[model samples]
Target chain A: MSVTVIIAILVVAFLAGMDGILDEWEFQQPLVACTLIGWLLGDVTTGVLFGGSLQMITIGWMNIGAAVAPDTALAAVGAAIWVCGPAHLTVAEGLAIAIPLALIGQGLTVIVRRLVVKLVHYAERSVRQGNLNVITRVHLLSLTLQGLRVVIPTALILLVPTTLMQTFKAGLPHNVVMGLAVAGGLLAVVGYAIVVNMMATKWLWPFFILGVVLAAITALNMIALGLIGLALAIIYVQLQSQTRPPSGPDDEMDELDRELEDL
Target chain B: MTSANNQMPKTLTRPDLFRLFWRSSFEQGSWNYERMQNLGFVYVMMPAIKRLYDTPEDQRAAVLRHLGFFNTMPYMQSTITGVVANMEVQRANGSQLDDQAINNVKVGMMGPLAGVGDPIWWGTFRPVLAAFAAGLAQGKASLIGPLLFFFGWNIARLTFRWQSQKVGYSLGVTITTKTGNLLPKLTQGASILGMFVMGAVIPRWTSIEMPTVIARVHAHDQLEQLTLQNVCDRILPGLVPVLLTLICLWLIRKRVNPIWLMLGILVLSIFGYSIGLLGVK
Candidate 1:
């Protein structure tokens, strides 16, 4: 890869890490990470496209409280950078490497968070002393640490011997690779099941099944599919609202609907 | 009025603006203190801090501190624009810029804008681009795919930054009046677009086909032949993909982790390939 491209990738990784630490929701997700990495690697479009595909597969995935989803930021960013970078790997191949990279990324995040806790204490002292400069420095320090989390790993991956890497990849039997792909597909289904169970209501199952069927059969685009699904969801919500006993205020009902809508 | 009114105006320069923009853009990645300092120093301050020597120390410090917090590029742009506008109005009205107010505005807007902008920019837009690129990858249009990806994303990013800054400036008077209800509607629209592209692209990009078996029935003096496709059509048309999907569903319902599931599938595929159970052409 060109030195400029490598620098760009490193910058993107650093930014992605910052996004995660800042809790900029989308930044931590694959969409932005992949796009930025892709753009820097001279293929923004592919980066965005791959990022989006991975986004859907992990649509219902979230890091609620302590439960960590696969580190999509790493997967998306790493995949794009590797595929669109000097590596020139196909999306599938890039993803094959990227997925494991995401798991490793998650480990890095855990370590960063643990380290950040100590910094927060330092910030508390700065705040008590009325040292706004120190407080600001502490914030900067935290963000830098987060950026390093991504930069260090990505640099290492890029720096590794390509021939050695190829041999390592080749050493895995064909069955193993295919089996992993199948397993990934299956796990995606499991992720969907979690969402389905969370949104359980007798009437919605039909719509859910209908969605699966439609997705399986017709070659309708996601936009068309989403509109259909959204329309159905809205109708279902309205009907359910009407049939229910009037036991609450309008605001309360709205809140309940909003909560349900989120699911 | 007697002493404060006689103070010289704090003249802002181009470098001040550049510093602000640079800081905002670099801060886009700040998740913690270390990242903020490193990125802030390298990407933000290093470019503009030298210019600060010509300005008043307090103003310089204020500007530096303002750029310190966690921010995304667009969010940072919007927040900085908002603060600048606020300062301009204060200057015009014969009052010094309220440091707390500027900080409040910066901190206040970053969260919501980041919340909305991040997902819309990354989750929705990027994926649509990836879907197209995946098709290109399949076609071996290698260079074209990546080029298209970059063009689409930068256009979106730059547009968002400009639009957000405009909104921040124009609506500074009653910023709260700007509602985010519009976001969900926009996201809904984008989601539809995103999914459509994914559906069209995934099959082409990924290996999702299955092998089929055929059985024939023959009479004493007659023989019959049937193709795998014909047999499949007879017993539930388009069964293979559906069967694959259903199998995925079954595995999902069992609450297995994706990593383990992936490992399982890889093993199964290799086994099937070796045994010739899954015919590989």
Candidate 2:
């Protein structure tokens, strides 16, 4: 990789790191994250293809309440490097690598979040001291740590020279490679099931069934279905609200639809 | 209520609002299980709090007030931040308000705003555009996917956040009266759409197939073998994937750890593929 490529990846990684925590910019989403890396690697097209596929597999991932979801940022960058770099792996192969990367990112995220507790403790002191500058610095430092979480791992991955990556790719058996491809496809099932588990209510099972049946029979596509969903959702909301009993209004739930998306 | 002009003793300048808007993006910087987004919320309010409360005691109290537990979607955060900042100004100016009122606003807003934001952003708009973009990328228009998604999502989201802050600030407490009817309906509609989209994708994203032949049968003109997956497709186009998903759901319900389940699926895939029972479509 050229210095330009490596530096670009680091900068993107740094931004993604911060964005991952903020959950804004969505620089962490595979679609965007991988594309940025792909663009830097001079293969914006492949980066996008990989990112989009990867995004579907991770579509249901989210951080609900306090639980951290698997890290899409790590999955995107690591998988992008493998797919777009010297290895030139297929999207399925890149996705296979994303599963473990997600886990690793999750663990690292937990640790980083925990480590920032110390910063919070220090922030209390700055608050007491009436030192606005210190208060600002503490927050900035915490943001830096978040950025480094993605950058450090990404930098390390790029440091592996091209020949090593080529040799690494050459060594894997064809069957093993095929198995990983199969694994990647099935992993997507896991992702969807996870979403179903969180979002599906007993009353909502019909909707799930409805979607499956329609998809099975028609080529009407997701966009068309999405439009139908929008119409039905609007209608359902109006009807349900009108029918609902006028009781004291507090639907406090540690939502039974509990699932974590970001690491 | 926002201390906008009439009272005019002080104001949150455009620079301060800009700073706060950008700074508020860091609300999850130190997310901890204990307090969630509490510290970040305090961090965001610091500028406004410091500007409003000149006395050290009042400043420290203001900071302490905001450090309580807070959690909400980042998109909807500026609304609460703006409202609280406005209310905090009122309190600083000797309005007959207590910290509890600000706390009430924060707590009250987090739930409904989140209830609204998640379904729309996470569930509906995001999935719709992303899946569309992903589909495009998978086809020949690969470059368009990420560019459309990034620019499209950020444009809507950034504008909404900025506008929401301004609206929330301008309306003050009355923001509640206007939004009470709107939020619940928007949330319900979005969630419904989200659920529907999720359903549509089940057949597309989830993959399951049975490669083994279940039986041999005489066809109209030739000998034929029936595959298990063929039977499933005849019965239901996505039965295998749906069944697989349900089984995974049951495993999750049974408290089988998700990581272990993921590993199990990993092993199952490798074994199935090695034995010629599973392959990518």
Candidate 3:
């Protein structure tokens, strides 16, 4: 690859790493990051082709509380680099490369997050001293460490000969690769599980069941279902609120209890 | 600190609000296992902290006070930041709201907001838009898929981040005063809608089609077996995914660590595939 392309990859990787944590722009996500990498490599087509599918698989992976999900930034960028750049693998093979990389990326994120805790202590120190600049710099520095979490690994991977990966791909067994694909499909359940678990309440089980049945049985579009849901929610909220007596702290607390099942 | 004289020392300028809004986007950057996003939370409110506390000790206390455990839905945090900023301003004006109360509000709002926000934004909004975008890419508009998702999600969310803060600031203390149980009612409303959308879409995203069939059965010509998917559809369409989701729900209620459950799903999938019980759609 050209030096400028390498620089572009590094720059994008750094931003993606930081964005992974920020989650503001979501530049770290496959759809955006891979597209950018592909554009940089003059292979925007393949970059997007794989990025689209990867986005669906990793869409639900997020940091809920202190637990970090798989690192989308690292996996997305790393897979894109391999697929769009030297290795030039097919989208399916690129996905196989990307999926396992998610586990590695998850490890890196947890470690980086732990390492950043020391910086948080420093930030605390800076706060005690009443130095806003120092504290802000520390926070940004912590963010940079996260950036390097992806950049350094990506640079190291780039150092290896692309031919080696090609050879490695050739040697990989079909079942194992197929297994990874199946793993990707199954991983969707985890994402849905977490969401369902969050939204699942004793009174709400019927709604969950209703959603599944509608999706399975009918050819209704997503927007149509969303509209149906909006209608159901409005009707329920209106009827329920009207039936309730004057609002009290106890009543609010009970509603809030139903709000937090896991908590 | 009580709101002495019922007036603030200073009003935040537009630039300050703009700066705070921008900074709030990185509110999870310094996330740590011990205190979660506490430092990032403090960092985002630095503008407000600096504006409110002129004395070094006051500023120090202000910063340190926010450096406790804080986590919330990323996009929805702007409201908290805005409300907290206003409270800090009130505190600086010498309000009765002490550090403990401020922290209490911060701590209290996050969970309920997280409960409401996680499902609405991350759970529903994201998956719906993203799946569509991904679907578009799988179709003729491959490039447009990423473009649409990138622009659609970012524009929608960034606007939300900006606007919610404005709404929070405008509503400010009135949230506790003017509206009794309004937040809860809103939470109830939001969650219901969330469940509705979730109901319609969960089955579609969740794939648990059964390709397995009875083995060693003789029928039409050689060996024939009942199609499990057909049977499932006859009983209830999308039964497998729904049942699978419920099983996951049961496991989660049983206090299974989510990460372990995720790994378990992976292992189960591998085993299921190897044993010819599960196949990828």
A54-169, model 2: which lDDT tens digit per residue? 98778767776677888888889988998988779888778877878888888888888888777777787777786655666777787888889889998888877768867877
- Candidate 2: tens digits of C-alpha lDDT, residues B62-147: 88778778889877899988888889767877787898988999999998888778767776677767877887887784688888
Q: Single out the weakest 10-residue window by summed lDDT for candidate 3 chain B.
A: B1-10
Ranking by lDDT: 2, 3, 1
Q: Is 1 or 2 the stronger prediction by lDDT?
A: 2
Residue A61 in candidate 1, Cα distance off native in Å: 7.7
What does candidate 1's lDDT look like per residue over B36-129, in tens digits?
A: 3222322333323333223345334544444445444344344446444545445434565566665666567656655555444544455445
Q: A-chain TM-score per prediction?
A: 0.76, 0.88, 0.83
What candidate 3 gets wrong by more than 4 Å, as runs, is A177-186, A217-219, A247-263, B1-9, B53-58, B94-101, B202-237, B252-281
The list of candidate 2 runs beyond 4 A from truth reads A244-263, B1-7, B54-57, B207-209, B213-226
Candidate 3 residues B1-281, lDDT tens each?
44346554766788999999999878888877788888888888889877767678888888888888988888778988888888887777766788899899888778877766776777667766776677677455378889888889889988988997987787875664554456566666656656665565555655554677754567778876766765776787656666666687688779875556656666676677677776766
Cα lDDT tens digits, model 1, A18-67, are 76644333565555677667777778667766665554455445443234
DockQ metric for all predictions: 0.15, 0.47, 0.43
lDDT of each: 0.53, 0.78, 0.76
CAPRI accuracy category, model 3: acceptable
